[model samples]
Target: MDADKMSDLHEEGKNAINAPMLPIGTDIHPEDTLLEENAERIMLDPTSRENLKFKDLLKVLIDWINSELEEERIIVKDLEEDCYDGQVLQKLFEKLSGRKLNVAEVTQSEIGQKQKLQTVLEAVNELLRPHGWTIEWSVDSIHSKNLVAIVYLLVALAMHFQAPIRLPEHVSVQVVVVKKREGILQTALVTKELTSTTEMMLGRFERDAFDTLLDHAPDKLNVVKTSLITFVNKHLNKLNLEVTELESQFADGVYLVLLMGLLEDYFVPLYNFFLTPENFEQKVHNVAFAFELMQDGGLKKPKARPEDVVNLNLKSTLRVLYNLFTNYKNSE
Candidate 1:
């Protein structure tokens, strides 16, 4: 083969490996020809627990955006795909801030889209700066349709605006970033938070105390269990039931449901749940039902999953009970 032809083939091989996976019709960088080098990435284990929680946060954010932009007839189903152009983001900023943004409503060229993103993000940062907060996203990240960075920006915006969304507090996701830095392939697994703030600081304090009790202070843990047992029995005594082991007694979720009913002064209908759960699925059903009841009573939704409670996960069970205890400790 001719020298120039051989060189062209070698470059094609290199570009194929480095090309980013972008949606069709999306414009690439101006300097790039067939592909953008060092733009390829792989998100490891998309179905992991942490990733599932991250997906939940994404859904909540999308729902919040759709609700806010309902008047504009803009429904955002995919944050990465829809918001990358900056049209939806511009409208969202205008809606939340109650101020008009001087940006184009539609931009086909990449430069115009990026300019719109720059303007919107700068305005957002201005509003967030007064509260000692700044967005962790950039125009490049948003334009690249980075889901994690987009989520962080939306969460900060929601918190600053008090958008009335039920954000999942204290949730983090493991992200695998693979990039070529200085001609070397580097892979890093990073755990990033999906949301945060003063509320999270308090939650972290509570979690750290629980860890300290669990790790360095068995006696203190036992005292907490005993106090919780006393609290449980105070309400369960009406049905001639008692809790001896905080972990095992709450495993099946029967006592948990009864305790919530007695604590909140509401009767859970027998038809709504199995009075005597005979199988694991039924136990999970009972626990899941109990959480719905908790929400209905205007209590904070527990971060613990129903299956975790059914399996007697100590940390998950403790988190649910502790949330209930803190809220009703002074009530009845």
Candidate 2:
């Protein structure tokens, strides 16, 4: 009977191999996932600093995010449900990093929310990477409303941005991570720390050479910008794009994104971004997305904030262009 079942399975596989191809644009829905939920059972003592760590840090992070996004009127009551849709995160990042993200303001669908989460998290990781901070959460974990993971990310962001909130030093929380698989269930006790500001040792580096040159030497700055402009136009001409006003032109992030694709020999998907930004928010979002792409291509993350470039800040814009120029000056 086992041999007969094997033969039947082989025939079914053969039939599947010979099945007709589906037409383009067909909607292929995927099966539901196993709901990857890692439940965290907090073991708090309420008296010990280690025990009070999670509660103290959670309140600090929530307050910091609320204050940062007060103008947007986004109050993050719980990191789980409030952040699952990505709107709050997007706004928080814009306020922290001073850059708007090119994601939907409101995503109702699971896939849409996940996509936005991926973008926001990638940008967050890029910002944190230069500081030697490691990312502790994934899109799935955050989307699934894992409280522990959410708290970890918020703590990291708060510390990285130096949010004006009082977080206890050496805060640790004992938690049991519960997982079930293949009809088996298991739990592991983990001690997680709400890392303090001192533990990070994130020191700010000196301003970029371009920024310094523009400050002390205006004539030389013009010469350098002109040289970079010529280099930019040489390639941009291929796509009929020009950079007559480097400060104002690249502020929108459209030209910068296109220029990066041209020099790096990659395609910036149109659907992935807005081609014609309608407002200041969209412009900043485009610039931020460009910066992410630059980091993805192994380029050093620029020090300039996305909003700075969008606002036509000469030092910030020059810093970004100068970095690209130094890297791809000799490239075809």
Best by TM-score: 1
lDDT, candidates in the order shown: 0.76, 0.73
The residue-by-residue lDDT of candidate 1 on 1-332, one tens digit each, is 99999987886676566644433333334322322357545343343334666777788899889978999999999888998988998999899889999998889999999999999999998887777765678898889887777877888787666654457666777655566543434445667766654356334324445656776887888788877778778789988998888778888888888888898898888888878899999998899789888988898666666777888878678778887887888876
Highest-lDDT candidate: 1
Tens digit of per-residue lDDT, candidate 2, span 1-332: 69999987876575445434433332222211122444332322223323555667777788778867888887888877898777888888888898888898788999999999999999999898887777778788788776667877887786677553445677666544444333223344567765644423223333457645865787787788789889999999999877787879888889988988998898889987789999999998899899888888888767666877988878778878888888899999
Per-residue lDDT of 201 in model 1? 36
Which residue pairs clash within candidate 2? none
lDDT score of residue 42 within candidate 2: 32
Per-residue lDDT value at 278 in model 1: 98
**TM of each candidate vs. truth:** 0.53, 0.46
Displacement of the residue 106 alpha carbon in candidate 2, Å: 0.5
For model 2, where is the 10-residue window of minimal lDDT? 26-35
User: In model 2, which regions exceed 4 Å deviation?
Assistant: 1-51, 179-183, 197-332
TM-score of 2: 0.46
